[model samples]
Target: MEKTYLRAVEVDQWQTRQDITVTIPDSFDREVMASLPSLPDEPEKAVEWSGMLEMIGNASGVLWQKDAEVESLKTQIEIQKKAMLDECQGLQAELKEARDETHRANAAAALATNRAIKAEAWLQQVKEALASGFAPHLGRAPVERPSVLLAR
Candidate 1:
């Protein structure tokens, strides 16, 4: 009977390589070994190794799905952040416009107040001139008027 050596390769967490050996039984089914991608010489050990490989594949698939979900969430968060920033900028512009309008209103009110003050001063001058009997001399040809002399 020829002895066959079965090689098992295992990698650590750090990906350091290690080799394991198991003896093959002579009575092992050749048909089952042919179906497996990598043949383990021992029948019982082959079943265990195949199960472990299946588990590793399943775990890797789950990790990949989780990574994809994380990426999608990150993209959504970025989009929301950009929208919020745009809203803030719009509000800032509106605030600036409101401030400018308020300033313009204040300037208009000040001008109105100044014009009212000048009008009041002119009215006072007119009142003084009329009280002093100087209204007839304003912008017209002089007319002779009879004056009554009063004794004080």
Candidate 2:
């Protein structure tokens, strides 16, 4: 059994250096060693052909999956953001509607109070006219204010 030293050859205009150390296992001649390309200073560059190809393929697949997952997460985040924005707008609209309803209710209450005051003033005037007919001296002077009834 003869020791077969592994070697590497730099190909013309290629980034990858070819493994030129594929020994004819049965050949034990020293002249065969001379024909092989020179080995590099770094021994890690030499690898079993099948294993290195598998590693490269697996790495590419993982990178592709990572990119796809990132895109999916980004889309989900955008959808969630849009939903939150829509909810905010809906809440704002509801708040505005509530404010408008409160304003209308306040205006209606003020109008009702004004009408009540006018009605009370008219009723007092009519009462005074009726009393003047019975006493004959009720309407001879300045009329008493309706606000005096509220004070009593």
Query: Per-residue lDDT for 1-152 in model 2, tens only?
Result: 43333344447765764555443333434445456565778656644544444465567557656766897999999999999999999999999999999999999999998888778777877787666555547546554544333311
| Candidate 1 ranges beyond 4 A from true positions | 1-47, 129-152
lDDT of 2 at 99: 100
State the C-alpha lDDT per candidate.
0.64, 0.65
Task: Write down the TM-score of every candidate.
Answer: 0.51, 0.56
lDDT of 1 by residue, 103-125 (tens): 99999999998887777767766
Candidate with maximal TM-score: 2
> lDDT of candidate 2?
0.65
Tell me how far the alpha carbon of residue 79 in candidate 2 is from the true structure, in angstroms, after superposition: 1.7
- Which candidate has the highest lDDT of all? 2
